[model samples]
Target: MLNKKVLSCAFEKTINIEWHKGQFTTNNFLHILIHELGHIFYFYDWETFKINHIFYLKQFLGHKINNLNKFSELDKEKVLKIFANSNYGLSDDDELLAEGFAYWLLTKQSMQTKIWEFWNEYFTSYLPQIRDKERKEV
Candidate 1:
């Protein structure tokens, strides 16, 4: 089996926005940043996540990902839907999670409580290291 820590995730960092009245704002960019941060949060915590919560993640996601390459399109989507909050998030599992987390952080209300708890644990446990790492780099 592929190691969960070796699996990849993609994310956006910066975005370009057109300036217009009553349109997008810095808050929109903050949401995108929050989504990207969720991906980083997972990246930095992959080992612990795999060791402790892989089964829960798979179960909560509602599809077996061990053979993702062989999944039928419909089957793939069934799993992805649990994390995707928008059509844009339907690309794959990672986006589903990132986008779903963005919505979760903003609303704080959803049926995705399992994922929320996972993220909460991740952040609770890792925030200190993350802050220290960035602080040292600065």
Candidate 2:
């Protein structure tokens, strides 16, 4: 049984990790947890995050454009390479961020590209500042 209020709160900065015994390996569990945390980070400053990463949003959306013939073959290849690490990221902007976050943390490697640089900075620097500011407000 799930509580509707709690479920609603989940969209409002609440993160609840439901653990199902033997359902996931340790690696999968950590990946999922980090991915969910990425969602919370995005929710913290939705507009700013979206604005700051518009290039990525556009590139991710390019996957769809490729199907419509609006994107060139080179651009499509670039988009494919960018999202090769996580196909799920091709789904949408939010999923792209979350999947990238999980991949970055799990691999413990810097992507060194412009979009990933922003993502890394968001999780490492911006998000902490936001949290600190909120703590002061409370």
Candidate 3:
């Protein structure tokens, strides 16, 4: 029964990516940052530490191989899919963690963020395997 604000506080403790105003408006770009922040909080949650380590390793290597911006939608989806679908991905845990955090931000009046209309379309495609009941319930 953790409140969204409580989850947000827990999530912010680990990830420190500064929000870039310019990128904030972009669809997948924002989700990318949110997803990485999820990993930070996932590590905070103490579930799958070594696997999260490997997830980052694969992300680093994938970025190196693709030479794409880490924030790029394609690049980010690659990382999210790999992390959320691998042994770590099996739980659908990361998606819930990330979406929970993002959902909090979306709900807070001070956050000044709209529910970017296209996010669902884009994220749903990347999240083919994981289902987010909370998102629907919200």
Ranking by lDDT: 2, 1, 3
List, residue by residue over 1-138, the lDDT tens digit for candidate 1. 644233322212223322132122222555766778867655554543332223334443443246764667677556646555555566555555566557667654655576566555444554445545655655
Candidate 2 lDDT (Cα, 0 to 1): 0.55
Global lDDT scores for all candidate models: 0.51, 0.55, 0.44
Best-matching candidate per lDDT: 2
Candidate 2 lDDT, tens digit per residue, 1-138?
757565556533322232223222222545777888877766665544333343434444454343634757566546644743454565566666777777667664553666555456656776566556656765
Cand. 1 TM to true fold = 0.44
Clashing pairs in 1: none
- Report clash pairs, candidate 3: 84-89
Per-candidate TM equals 0.44, 0.43, 0.27
Candidate 3: residue 17 lDDT (0-100)? 36
Model 3, span 46-107: residue lDDT tens: 44223343344344445444555545665665654442312323346555446544544453
